[model samples]
Target: MVSKELVLKAEIRKENGKKHSARLRLQGKIPAVVYGHKQEPQSIVLDLHDFTEGLHHGHKLFDIEIGSNKEKLLVKEVQYDHLGKKIIHADLIRVDLSEKVEVSVPLVFKGTPAGASEGGILEEHLDSIEIECAVTEIPESIDVSVKGLKIDESLHVRDIALPAGVKLVTDPELLVIACSKPIEVAPVEEAAGAEEPTSPEVITERKPKEGEEEESEKKE
Candidate 1:
């Protein structure tokens, strides 16, 4: 579980469009908007550094303080530049603490697989799963143990143990992880021996013309 308190101080944004957003970035602020449920979209601007630090803390819910007003929101989506290093845009969803929200939770593997010790390969199929739970009850990640997994054995979404009040929204049959035996490759020597080269006697030799042969005899 990840629990942290983050406070973002922002002000209502009056301007819109690309030019206004560029100006806001130049002023060291990030443009953002809040909307969800029955609330109308509210445009605002927050300090770039503060907004980034809040995301770094791993708290899904945000406590946004806009002047004298406080809004509880969930980080719905975050867009970044082509390099994936800078934040370009963000969407915040207002949510009540008691309300259940559907969100994707990351999956984490715990313990080494038994098949690995037996020289079998392990494969992960899914990295995350969607689940619905109360905002406050949101889990940081779901854990699935891979210990004692034999070759051809798999763990599905339904096998994962989730926190109380959490209901999985993904298909139960979705594979999370599996183990398989290593593929065997035959030796090159055997493959080469299986192929036989063509015999020279089977090939037809071209015959020389009679005039060319007479010219060759005169030269001799």
Candidate 2:
């Protein structure tokens, strides 16, 4: 998959303390640092919305323009607030189109597994995998199909098919997904029924009076 291109307009930051970073955030911008590949580290800030929008659309490669200088950068990490409701900071690394770069690519599963019909539960262990490949050959996401997978079977990192230039940085023996028998869950209703309350029943019947019974026998 190819990522949608996103352009971020950034301005070089002159300050580098928490107070200054707070001030930038108050102005609706996020503080960030860009440095890698023997390049000069630059302190910068960009619009919070611009950063969030690019991330939401899965744009890994960022085209950052600082003043008259423009360079292609890659998102390495992002720090979030305690509640994870806000973006606190971001780490950007300089990238060269001709060099191989390592990045984490999300895995997308396609199709239903045959084990699902056989009452087997499917579990996904990893959502993304790290790989090193040329900048131009990097995929937005890796696609893994779960169709025809049987119970007690699992797929590992080695099962993934990668591009010609791409190499898996994660361990090949690491489990990605698996199909197994459903775990046994205790039956709540059965347990509740075992301790059911038992209440006794009462019955009463009325008898005829002696005088009324004698009159009825004489008339008969």
Question: Which one wins on lDDT?
Answer: 2
- Collision pairs in model 2: none
Show model 1 residue runs off by greater than 4 Å: 22-28, 185-220
RMSD of each: 6.8, 6.1
Error (Å) of candidate 1 at residue 40 is 1.4
Per-model TM-score on C-alpha atoms: 0.77, 0.81
lDDT of each: 0.85, 0.89
- Alpha-carbon shift of residue 137 in model 2 (angstroms): 1.8
146-188, model 1: which lDDT tens digit per residue? Answer: 9979898999999999888899999999989999999999766
- For candidate 2, give the lDDT of residue 40: 85
